[model samples]
Target: MAKTTLSLLPLILCLLYISGTAASANFIKASCSATAYPAVCVQSLSVFATTIQKSPRQLAQTALSVSLARAQSTKSFVTKLTKFKGLKAREYEAIKDCLEEMGDTVDRLSKSVLELKRVGKARGPDFLWHLSNVDTWVSAAITDGNTCMDGFAGRAMDGRIKTSIRARVTNVAQVTSNALALINQFAAKY
Candidate 1:
């Protein structure tokens, strides 16, 4: 009986050791996966910011091509808030805030792109400078939109509000695509 009890003790210890090792491995894997979310968030933000920065330029170009009366200033285009009928005043206010926040983000990103170019010129590596500029612009656009969308509980609002938000998102997508194209053009030239 004493010998059997001793043998069982060793088996119990071995099982405990194995279980701990597995738990630690699983923990490490989960920690690594959790850390990756911020990086993904940053990348997403950058893409959105880049899109916002490019939208005005594309809109301006289209306006010019069609000979439509152009806004005397780019900032004018930035604040073109949409008015949706059937939305509550509170909903309208929320939408306005979202748009304003997004617009501010776009403006900041545009400035960052210019600043990157200036910094690149001052520094030695031209390629790195251009890449940095593109990265900054993209990051700014995405971050701004995400920030606004984070606050946008308009998903629960009326269909009009939802539709308006969708339209804005589509517009952002178009701008992002154009910015990517512009980046490709720059790359080709380089």
Candidate 2:
């Protein structure tokens, strides 16, 4: 009996591991489905699934951090682009505009982070209000990113710069959208 039990132990462990992974994936999918960009939401937040442990507040905080980090990186990228040689006046202006927008985006995300923290301490209706603030700020951050992208529309710039800026800003927007959705989900529970 001991020998048979020992032989089954590894199989049992493997099955448990697989089951845990499946459950984690399902949880991420369910949470991300609340967002507009579900695939991006899942991809961004799934990495932290184990650590997040299915806490809606933790999920919102994680999403905010991710969005803020991406916005900071993209802001830096756009600032550097302003220095690139041979840029036309319009291109330089566009880059500057994007830099300002990114700054605002970062600010909104920072506010959302604070709002999420407040949600933990506040009680009842106050908690709900804080969550609503977080959702609104995150949504505004997404809009800021989109407005930055719109600033570049129809501009005849170098393909490389255009593609790089668009990709980075789009990524920031998507993560911000996810953060808003997570905050909304958290609010809905209360």
| CA lDDT for candidate 2 | 0.85
Query: Across residues 132-158, which tens digit of lDDT does each residue of candidate 2 receive?
Result: 787777878888888887767784765
TM-scores of all models? Answer: 0.43, 0.85
Candidate 1 lDDT for residue 171 = 47
Top candidate on lDDT is: 2
Q: In candidate 1, which residue pairs get closer than 3 Å at backbone N, Cα or C atoms, i.e. clash?
A: 45-142, 45-143, 46-138, 46-139, 48-141, 48-142, 49-140, 49-141, 49-142, 50-138
63-121, model 1: which lDDT tens digit per residue? Answer: 12111111112223324434446657766676676677566655655554455345434
User: Which whole-number lDDT from 0 to 100 does residue 55 have in model 1?
Assistant: 37
Question: Superposing all C-alpha atoms, what RMSD in Å does each candidate have to the true structure?
Answer: 17.4, 2.5
Worst 10 residues of 1 by lDDT: 63-72
Prediction 1 TM-score vs. true: 0.43
